[model samples]
Target: MIPFLSAWPPSPANPTLPADELHVWVASLNRSQTQLNQFWQHLSEDERARANRFYFDHDREHYIVARGLLRQLLGNYLQLPAHLIAFAYGEHGKPELAAEQATSGVRFNISHAQGVALLAFSRNREVGVDIEQVRPLDDGEQIAERFFSENEVAVFTAVPPEQKPQAFFNCWTRKEAFIKVIGEGLSCPLDSFDVTLKPGEPADLLQVKGSREAAARWRLENLEPANGYAGAVIAEGREWQLRTWQWPA
Candidate 1:
């Protein structure tokens, strides 16, 4: 059987910022497409086909499951009808709300990689989340040199060779989370931003050009998604807290 993480109630010690504040949810899709068909049936044919175009079958299932979970969670959080929680994607494919909510000013973003998906929501602030499964690399250092900034490449290269893949994924997810929050796609150069993601340390903001002052309003966090993945979230404004819910089977 595919193991899944269930949403646990939050504790006072880990109190949510506010009912209306930012929250993050992570879901695992280790189920077969046939098992996920119940969720898939809710989408229009086009949406289902679009999701299916993803290279991996689990990617398709997780995307659909995450959207359904988002709709249900938004209904409870915003006290809006589930159908009213609409979505519209940006020119570069960043998803946003389609219609204004009665609550007003709520924003969210979603991302998935491997078998995991992440959703981030905030009140009066834009948010983005990204997760990547760390995979074995024959030459992770070489790939970092090709795609990462000179400073980032140097950092990875200095990682004693054994820990380079983890270091590379840490940096990649931070940069991707930030870029995803900016909604600029590849137009926002990766080299323009620098992120600090030293192993066992929290993600720190690094300066980047072309990101609006609005982008600076964001708070980014490195996430621990299950055992094999690295993840991060970028949200507008500081003084925010995150609550993660794992979707049930």
Candidate 2:
């Protein structure tokens, strides 16, 4: 299990992110209206436009908090003001620092579920993070059949009934993290790769269907960001250390 450090200073400071270390920050999306107003200013015009596209106020608020916090966090690392930081997207819409900021060698990915969000950052390598609030699912098997590789489906089917929810999410998060890091999005089928999903089993990228040596190029680590949540982080290469931190630090 990964441990999250809650020792954050109230004011921003330059944090060292070594090339061989990965940082994952956990934050709560729920914020007071005042705090929301402050965070809203951190977003770019394009981001605010995207947030406005959300029909529901709850979703719009969450989007504001997530993107705002993301800018603040990246701002600390880049030593730049949050509002001036720009972003560029990949062919599949995976966001990354603009070329100007990319020179800093910071690569990142973000995911949020329920009221929590996870942001992962690494230097000189791709990184992705995912968090999901565990909940009962009536269609777990049906969804697994549609998305899981053959080996994954068989193992998932044999899990004890009571452990199914956790197992399902464990698999879901790990796979999502992998695809996001690869920047292929769903264009890379979830069923085209395999991951370890058994409760208590170590998180891993087991195989990539056509690439004999692909699985060895990345590493997966399980995360428990908060109660009732399952999270995972993946990054290129296995030589790095994971430093988990809470937001507001």
lDDT of 2 by residue, 134-232 (tens): 888999999999999999999999999999999999999999999999999889999999999998999999999856489989999999887788999
- TM-score per prediction, in order, is 0.81, 0.93
lDDT of 1 by residue, 29-98 (tens): 5666664665565555566678878997656667777666566566666676654566777899887766
Predicted model with the maximum lDDT: 2
Clashes of each: 0, 1
Candidate 2 residue-wise lDDT at 205: 92
- Model 1 pairs in collision: none
TM-score of 2: 0.93
Deviation in Å, model 2, residue 158 alpha carbon: 1.1
